[model samples]
Target: MAISQEISYRLERLILDGGLAPEQKIPSERQLAARLRVSRSVIREALHELQGRGVIETRHGKGSFVSTMVPGSGDLREQGPLMHLFEGHPRTLYDLLEVREQLEGQAACLAAQRATSLDRHRITKAFRALEETDPLSNARPDHGFHQAIVEASHNPILVHVLNSLKNMMLMTVQASVANLNPRAEMRKKIVLQHRQLYDAIISGRPASAQKLAMAHVRFVSKSMRDLELEGSTLIRVPVEQEAAVSHQNAQD
Candidate 1:
């Protein structure tokens, strides 16, 4: 197979196998060329092929990305939802993150106020599953944990809205995760944020829960932006002092 074809195949597998999420931007051609040890022309050719196959797409200047509407992704559309419009755009996944921040923050606050013992149990279980999941596992139980939180809100409309947005959110998560090397020190920060959010919700602290949830989303959004600027799949993780402080507070 030609090198470009090979690159296309490898990237296709990343998409189909859940390594790359829909609507999530791929690394730039220069980055891909360097990573794959190929020329920029080869990377462009491979990206073009992926775009033709509907496995990925390229925005005018934003670079190429996996398609949010790929056949195997289930119920996703190229442009059916409001959120998908931002897909492959230049915002670096922030558009989707903004929607999520609004929706999920409310969900978390409501869950704090409204969750029954049983709902809390389910949410806790889901959080456990998410915690145990390998961070590199793309976006599986992460969505599950958040979905559980939404359900715990006891608001049918919020649950419905969250459910509706999940497809696009999944794509966003895939893209954000693509650049995260889970073994890095930033793992503590991720763990700290999620754990704090879970604790706040389960403890019936609506204000705390809402704040924590939004903070988590914003962190992910910023990370996506940083990854895009660097033009590489390997994202650099900075040690967050706040995360350490939060961890100690949690312990107390």
Candidate 2:
């Protein structure tokens, strides 16, 4: 396969398999090229193709993002467990975070009350791994650490809900790091809040853990809102793209 085609296929798999989720911003062309050991031009070609197919969207200052794929590219019927998704809505992505704040706070409270010795150990290990790292450098691990908290909660329903929304969670993580990493003070505050949340969960402080979880999610919500107000240059979306199967990515 041609280099650009190979990259395009690779990204397609990620989106289809949910490695990339709707509204999740992807790496910059330069960063993607670096990761794939290819030229920026190759990455650019793949991205434009992805864009044309309605599998992704690009904003001039914000970089590319995984959106809903083109019709016939995949099956996305809203049935069974995911019926609530319906047609999906990117503008309401923030609504998920608002729900996550409440749901995850309850998870933290459950973890604080019910976590066994091993669960506490795992939660601590996960949190510690994320504690000091630069948020911009590795968002996946940061995302994993938070997932660990839900696991520690020992509640199957909570775990299932969070797992179903994993892609969205990672998207939020990407957005958080993208916006906050450039601001030293805010980044530090985020890390500190994460640490405090971890401490509360592991130390068996249910109320504190719940409070911290709510606060942390609220901070993430505010950060995204702040970014929207910044008004970065926008990439012009081509009009002839394939019909998208789900929500459109929010563009400038």
Candidate 3:
């Protein structure tokens, strides 16, 4: 194979193998050349070829980014209308959690089965970040931990789809954390559940990881439902007390 063709293949493999995520910025040509031990001209030719094939895109001032047009990936903008609808409906948060229950569970299972050494390191880093984060303000780190698991699955389609739904997922997580954080018991349970899920993944127990991940989502869903129900329950006011307060307000 030609040198430039070989270079292009290597770059493509980096993207397909999850080394370079969709929409992530690729290293500059100089960086790529140095890393690949190739001449700048060859790096430029390979990048151009990849760009022609829609594997990457370059901006005028910014360097190339991995194209979101990877196999089985779609434009996130296509879901804009549906996402707006979801944002307007409180119940959609539950729907999002339901989706998470399935996707995250499967991702955990795959991660347990397939995680490389680097993937394990990334997952461990994300887990530790979550551990050190304040429970009351852990939405981002928690999301990062889950995202790392999904990426570790090494399924490009799964990674891209979940990344596309990033906004809705974060919204759901933020809601759950915000509502459950005020309850000390619930918060502690959540932290423990996360630890269990992380342990299962790291131990390479696919079944345990899947079960723990699904259960964690279910627990969050149930807790949020309970909190919503509690908020909606009406407290009875004495009729005479209400009447007296109304009468005094009229006089005032």
Candidate 4:
């Protein structure tokens, strides 16, 4: 990693570990530079990274302070039990689903062209297991299936993008499943749709796999929106609106 990245990583860790609290001021530029034994420029670069992540805020002539309730500011470094992901905004989730569909569709196409026998075996096993389990228990394994496809593509950049997308997909699925209308039978249909995607992947048909993956993602996205509309009183979506807001999940 570059020097700036190394510094940013450490500073982010400090924020995640609760060394810094919301609205609390951080060390001044010179103080930080002295403490870290780095030049002021390096400190500035690191501070900029923290700001981008929504962990800190800068005020004109007042130095930098920790931002409380910032987007993606929660402690994500520590792996724990399932974090509560309340229902996301209908439009925002819809948009994210679209982005994911575009990325994963490309990933599926690449995987079809490049996947080795071992990659095929792993994806097949994951799909088979997903088919046998309940939706709630199968969410992570379902993630594994998608992740395997990205890895099989042999493109590091695509792998990174898909890796980052996995968390939101998992959280969205969990929320959608939990908020589903039992009478509508959305969950069962969703599982079946996923099965179709898996089948297409196994067949080594890139175009078919891509199409199926897109339909499956859009299906879940629409389901979540439908649930929000029908049962708006029960779901807990965020009121704050920001274009391209981070979900604060660490899985990415």
Model 1 agreement with the true structure over 1-252: per-residue lDDT tens digits: 899999889889888998988788899889988988989999899889888677887898888878877856464333444544544455634665688888789989999999999999999898888778776663556667887888888899888876656544443333454355363766677778889999999889999999998888788777667766778763222222223221110000
- Cα-based lDDT at residue 246, candidate 2: 52
Q: Model 4: per-residue lDDT, tens digit, 1-252?
A: 777789888877887778777778888988988887889998898889888776789898999998887536365543322233324334555666788878888888888878899989998887777677665455456667777888888899988876655654444433444454243477677667777777777778899888877777777667666666776623443422332334331111
TM-score of 4: 0.56
lDDT of 3 by residue, 104-178 (tens): 889999999999999999999999998898866776687789889999999999898776555444433335565
lDDT tens digits, residue span 187-250, model 2: 7787788889888988899999999998988887777776666764212122223433253222
Q: What is the lDDT of residue 232 in candidate 2?
A: 46
Between candidates 1 and 3, name the one with more favorable lDDT.
3
Report lDDT per candidate. Answer: 0.72, 0.72, 0.77, 0.69
Work out the TM-score per prediction.
0.56, 0.56, 0.57, 0.56
Model 3: residues >4 Å from true position, as ranges?
1-79, 87-89, 169-174, 232-252
The residue ranges of model 2 lying beyond 4 angstroms of the native Cα positions read 1-90, 169-174, 233-252
- Listed per candidate, the RMSD to the true structure in angstroms reads 17.5, 18.6, 19.4, 10.0
How does residue 236 of candidate 3 score in lDDT? 19
Q: Is candidate 3 or candidate 4 better by lDDT?
A: 3
- Supply candidate 3's per-residue lDDT for 221: 77
